[model samples]
Target: MTDIVVSTDWLADHLDEVRVVDVRDGWEFDGIGHIPGAVNVPFDTIRAAEHAVERGADPAEGMLPGVETWEEVLGGAGIEPDDTLVAYDDTHGVFAARFLVTALAYGHADVHLLNGDFSAWSRDHEVERGTPEVEPTEYVARESETSPFVDFETVEAALTADDVAVIDTREPDEWAAGHLPGAIQLDWRELVDDDSRGLKPDAELESILADHGVTPGARVLLYCNTARRISHTYVALRHLGYEDLMFYEGSLAEWEARGAPLESA
Candidate 1:
């Protein structure tokens, strides 16, 4: 899997070459200005929101669906496998970064997350209003995700494993609310810094992961209430050369649904 990110300046220079996607809520896209030529692909559209609605799943859960659904959602946004995609969010890069991860899971290789997001980009970049039209394409998913993502079963098995590191990338309150029995706390926001509030310097990032016992050699599973917050940490660790990184997309909420015990620590 490719572990690279693009800066706002670079995106501005090649807006014509790259497919710029805004992954904010639909209302936010209408109310807030966006990058010129950018198309809306709200984060939920790429996730399992539809599936959740059909099955009566939790409203806040954000996870992936089947490949067919992914292909349709992406194609509807004019996304093709060969196109270079750069996604950004109005607030945090969670939605934007998740966009990149979701694309990879659907076999789209040329994807990127805009470093500073819309807030960082809008400070000096060109902004536009109104929506843009996009013609759907016949895109097909060739694989799931290139990065490691575990099912609830796999995560449960790892819970007792000595070598595996399970990290809870939620806020302290979320942690205190209730979490997986053996998860260690590591807030996602603290691991990143900069005007964009993205990943910090490589050295600092390394230190954060190291402190959490999530070194390159460790088999790590990261998660939050939903998958969005954890994805921010996943991106940072992936860039730090943590190949054994795994995303527990189901997270603790899914775990509880499975009758798994929780620890209110």
Candidate 2:
């Protein structure tokens, strides 16, 4: 399916055919560990600083690293270009979604976000964990120039516009710690079902938006700590037929770099 959410059973059945990624930050994965055969890529390092110049990232923001950069990483992890990618993280679906969106934008098809994320995966008692075996291969990531990245200029304009809604998809603690001014909080965890396993029920998602006063035609800007999890919210909103959604690609990292206004509430 174009909508990729795989069950634990499915993952187990096809473990070797899928390139599983534990996209959690260093601290999170360090303590709790990850799936067997899954490789670790701390979320922010998605853009290789040295290769950014050729990978479609803004030069001023630091370009995204080229295909060789991803090639080295994925190749080192024994990943094959033909294999499906399955990503997961502890931060609900935000990081996983962000990774999937960026991967798709970079032309990596056959990608899936593990349904219900790490929580659901951990619920099963027989699952195995291991330090992934590493091997080498010549890999390449095809780049796309039109991935709809939102920069500071766009964010500034949206902030002043009455028609736009800037969403902060961080956890409640992080949101309370601080956020961009005029942004609304919507923890990504709440957007998925705890039982059925993938995205939240459609009616429930619509009700959540209604509670937040987000309407169909609203121009929405979605962001999280690093723009990782925010992309999932972007996809979720789009699924609900929100027509004018954009992802703040660099997210709070870029906002803080630009000295944008922020507040704690």
TM-scores for all candidates?
0.83, 0.67
> Which regions in candidate 1 have their CA more than 4 angstroms from the true location?
50-62, 145-147, 251-264
- Model 1, residue 3: distance off in Å is 3.5
lDDT of 1 by residue, 187-254 (tens): 87876675655667788877877787777778887777656777777777776777777776664545
Candidate 1 at residue 8, lDDT?
Answer: 80
Best by lDDT: 1
Q: State the C-alpha lDDT per candidate.
A: 0.75, 0.69
